[model samples]
Target: MSFHEGGPRAAQQKDTRSPGTGAGTVALFTLATIMCLLALAATYYFFVRTTTGQFIDESALVRADTIRGRAGRASTEFLDWLPVTSLVIAAVVVLFVTIVRRRWTAAGIAVAACMLANLATQLLKDWLPVRPYRGVQTLELNSLPSGHTTLAASAAAAVFLMVSPRWRPLAGFLGGTFAVASGVSTLINQWHRPADVIAAFLVVAAVMLPAGWLVLRTGKDWNAWDGDGGHWASSRFWVLLPGIAVVVSAAVAAYALRELILGMEVTDSTSSYFWAGAAMIVGTGHFAMVAAVWLFSWAARRRGPARR
Candidate 1:
């Protein structure tokens, strides 16, 4: 008797993934989330509680005045534009990707994470204690995890989540640049200190890492793609370039710190401290983006055909 082989064969082919498909992804993301939280706490402890940290932070703010000019006005304009820009990025990217790819669950998770990150920032701002007397002249108010920086970074992360793995590297890099620029703009405008911006980066990372893990798990079909070089956006350069930026910025920041430590005759009007703060923001934002790219790439399955 001839038997039709289509039914069982099709069923077998329907699912090739094992039960423990994304366990490693989950564990890695959990560890990353913990790291982000710990980094945020350390930021607060160092920049808010310690005397030397307070001095460095306040010095950056003071040095900001020395750069006030056309550049400052440009930064002010960018700051004014930040809220609208953030909303537009999230709304447009999420809606377009969702409608096109029909990624309803991914979109929902991303939007939710973005909102949660922003809300968490506001809550932290209000609930955190006032900067206590650390024997350094500085603002007494609490401004950890800057509101604008949180909004910008989380919005970028939302876009990163909506895109397929093939496009994530490019998206992550561009989004990182935008977030870093927003953070630096806040500093250039003297609206928030460097620590606040870095804290915002950590907050977005902590919130989005789990959301990314969920995306990889649920959207496994779309998440899998050919390994890097399949597309220009998927190229390793996207990650490597950001890593290079982190290294260069770190070096600049280190030089600035060394100068300060050696008791160099650096005046308040000098731009060294401001540059150092900007470098720190650039390094931190890009580092977070790079980490996200690496973590998601690791979790996402490679060399798989799209499953219906």
Candidate 2:
């Protein structure tokens, strides 16, 4: 209907995503999802399947063995509670926000995304062939995408999706941090390899990106936002902290794992370098995702002041 016949209320309900920006957003999200899936493939192939990969993968377990004591037990105990606790908290928070905002479609999209991510993890784990015994000491079963890490990351992503764009950067940072910490905790506890944690994150990204686009498309008014104001708390600090985290962690990981690249016949399982490298992967993956999603939202932002 024309604007006049459609009336004020009808016009008010118009989509916030403009046609020009909508196409771009769709393209960006599609590419991001594909890239994440590709990265996931590379991680599984290079870090989980090969003989060299198994050697590197089991290195962290060597460190975990050394640290087996009260500290290790305590860490495992905490992580045991993390998956359920984080999801419950994320669900409650997201549900409250979605209800208050009354964005029913957005809520559905977020929940569906979370469920699909977790389900995909389990399905992939069961369907993938068992890891070949490449003379590695690690378990032979397929453990690509970790169930715990998938649950944690998807929970956080759900919360990140439900928040307003103005608040999303900060929320994304916090959510991603929680997810990364959960992944690292699994490593420190010896429950999963770094590749498992990394794969879980990639799976969450693949599922959530397209779901996020749907949320934006259906709840356009709620998703729209203005450019970041001069407030440090708003956007600058959110992106800055994660940026620095990714940089520092990358440097440390590169330095710590340089021997692997040098072809030195070192297979020490008790090396702290393994844990450091795993933590670095977790940090880099989660933070980079936060920045990417935030940049997309910022690009699609409305130019004028936020709607009243």
Candidate 3:
């Protein structure tokens, strides 16, 4: 008999189907565009006017000093590493999807989306006349959208696209956290203004959402393909535990290293311990939820047989 004979087969077939251009994609793109426009307006209003420019520059300098004082040298260095790490993580995610799941088209789409976003950001930066604060020069060009923010947003979007739906919430949480942290760090480091970071994020999202929709419509089962059905498989339950452990451990170690080895003080008050505790609880709860779902499914299947 064919695999389609079973009830499970029908459900599986339906589950594997792709979603078309939905309201979510449309809304996301629309919002992104609005944000980009708003960012542009903000940049012009604040930077072009002399009085507004002075206020913004003063504010930026104050904010930069606050962040620098709070985070110190180690945090500054760590923030500097964010762009590199984001790129590496995005590359690794795409490589895993292609190599393990054999989803070449999806992987290609991810790469293309990232490249397009990066290229768009660079082009916008070059074309725009927004300038940075220079003591002698008054204003310097080529500082519209921050490249670090663009890279962070693009990388997060790529990772979100490649992961399974079951893990999407966690992926989103982590991705958003990383993006915000990166943007804030850039602003605090005096590398870019608030408007620049906002513009970069909006542009990246604008490119990625449509790209995600196109990838999804291409008949790829992004979620169903378990990663080789091994211990390292991309199950939501398994991923949460290990992913949290790794993130928490890394954060704690970095904090410790900064304090002891580098003689740097973290004045954030809420250090690695707070984050670690939160991660552990959230991860454990998510795992429990997945276990409950599996149990419910199994129970329903068993009851059906007995009724028959």
Best by lDDT: 1
Best TM-score among the predictions, by candidate number: 1
TM-score of 3: 0.60
Off by over 4 Å in 2: 1-21, 68-71, 230-233, 267-270
Error of 2 at 51 (Å): 1.8
Candidate models: Cα lDDT each: 0.86, 0.74, 0.55
lDDT of 3 by residue, 100-214 (tens): 7676877788789988998988998777665545432334565666788778878877876665544444555566557656766666666765556655666766676566666
lDDT of 1 by residue, 285-306 (tens): 9999998887777665432533
- Candidate 3 local distance difference test against the native: 0.55
Poorly placed runs, candidate 1 (over 4 Å):
1-15, 18-20, 260-269, 302-308
CA RMSD per model (angstroms)? 3.8, 4.5, 11.4
**Order by TM-score, highest first:** 1, 2, 3
Write one digit per residue (lDDT tens) for candidate 2, span 188-226. 788888888888989998998888877766765656665
